[model samples]
Target: MTTTNDTRGVASQELFERCTQIRQLLAAGNANFHAIGVQYNLIVDTRLAEKAGFKNAPEFLTQQIKELSRSTLVTYGAVARAFSAEVCSQYGVSLLNQLIVYVEAAGVELDANDPSTMLISVPGADGELEEKFFGECTVVDLRKAIQRLRRPTSSAPLPAEVDARAQQCSAALTGYFPQQTGVRVEVRNRKGKAVMSLKDVPLEQMEQIAALLSTALRSSRAA
Candidate 1:
């Protein structure tokens, strides 16, 4: 009877032969490494799908790869094709995955023509939006700049009555829209007049607010 060792040896030899053939094909320029890498990633992604009852890995990986900076993706793809996964692991390719979040949080748009520059929007001291150019920035530098930009600038306290009115407005809005998560309402005294501001209010909520105001106005007129 044939032993298990013989079968194992045969399988190993067959795998080695297939790898040699593939190497020769790639060397002769008859195979495309880019296409090969994509196919390989797809196969691995499929195998990784729904593993341990989690289906998010494949989709998340695809989206993360898609969202990488164009320059980073180009560099990574070249390195990946030349040395495959080993070079990617060595070069910390995961850093590219965080590029999107950094750019978005910085509230800046990347210049596709020049990755070293960004278009940033900042609010002026007078409450006007200002567009500015941030040049000569790498990904890490841009992230640091964004962190500084996001820091709170105002330390002044609100007037007591304005603060109280703001809190009352917030509480009333919350009570009115218990299911809404992002709604904000603020009421402040500005030059002896009440100024109200609403932010992140949903469209449906805005419509409801309008209807309620119209009803209140009609009832006041009837009185």
Candidate 2:
């Protein structure tokens, strides 16, 4: 029974190793193919379909590579050859997948100071551009970090009255919390209800703001 268990374990380990090897090879091949597609400009040119005896490029690819999805082809082809190669080699295919989504959404810029760092610009709640940095890190970790940074936390198209109130609140608080620069209050109307939000206030600053509010309330009560 012991020998049988050992043999099974060895077989499982071998299979796992083989799968890993195949995955890596597939990643490398995908990167190479994408680089070629970009260089040849075949990804976007639908006219090439007629020459290739197909109705369209999508049709040609679908028939030729039935297993591959059209979205994957387009995404891979969209990446710049240089960036694709670097991402695939250094970060592996998993990171390349997430990087493609970022590239498509808002675009990515290489950090001037550090070649290994990628800089993504996202819109802050205060209507300012905020930079999110991804240094040398695993794909899973970087993806999670980037997703958190990019997630939209605020509601949009507030009612005119709510918007005006939010603006007034922001202006009033700016005077009290001059040290907390670049913070804005947003008022959103949802289902006839008003929701107030303070954008980008750290915990310590929030405590300070709370104290100020408490003091003001006490003073009003005394008056």
Candidate 3:
């Protein structure tokens, strides 16, 4: 039993608010478009539509983009493909995983246990030979689950001397290594686990330290 006057008043108020919001959004969109055009030095001549087979400049641009899609330039191919796929999926992009893959493909030599490093293992010439290499170096610690990733070795069975020597070497070399003066090395055990961490040592020096640790561990075990 709502009164006609009251219902009309509510509808009118709702319509007014919606109109204001729509107007604001339209203004913002126009501003953004103009900014983009200026930045890109685009000539937005509306008259070019007839020659370009479109009713308006915007329509002309849209068709041009579609044409470009069929034969994409190498520089824009990957980005355009990703953008189109995301738009088809309601603007959802698989950014994080894709970036991780890209980062992990950039090669850099590093110890297997290094928390900042990722290793990619590939098959070698022989079926029994596996080639292990370092990929991207990152500051973000993926330590906990990194072992589950493709690694050359495991954790869990490193000699106590390996840990001690790595720390000693880190203390010995204070100002070297890219990105940080205090270099840290994380070594993976045979099981692909990062069982030791050493900081502030040069890559070459760390190798020597590892070799020494291996010998000491072997001798102690034999004794």
Best by lDDT: 2
Which residue pairs does candidate 2 place in steric collision?
none
lDDT of each: 0.47, 0.53, 0.38
- Candidate 1 Cα misplacement greater than 4 A, ranges: 1-48, 51-99, 119-135, 138-140, 153-223
Per-residue C-alpha lDDT of model 2 across residues 40-77, encoded as one tens digit per residue: 24434524444434465555555545544666555555
lDDT for model 1 comes to 0.47
Candidate 3 lDDT over residue span 72-111, tens digit each: 2221223333233323233112222232344454344322
How many clashes in candidate 1?
A: 0
Q: Would you list the rank order by TM-score, best first?
A: 2, 1, 3
Per-candidate TM vs. native?
0.28, 0.42, 0.20
User: Cα miss at 49, model 3 (Å)?
Assistant: 27
lDDT of 2: 0.53
**Which of the two, 1 or 2, has more TM-score?**
2
lDDT of 1 by residue, 126-213 (tens): 6564555544334454455455566644355566655555555555565676554767666555554556787787776687776654
Most TM-score-accurate candidate: 2
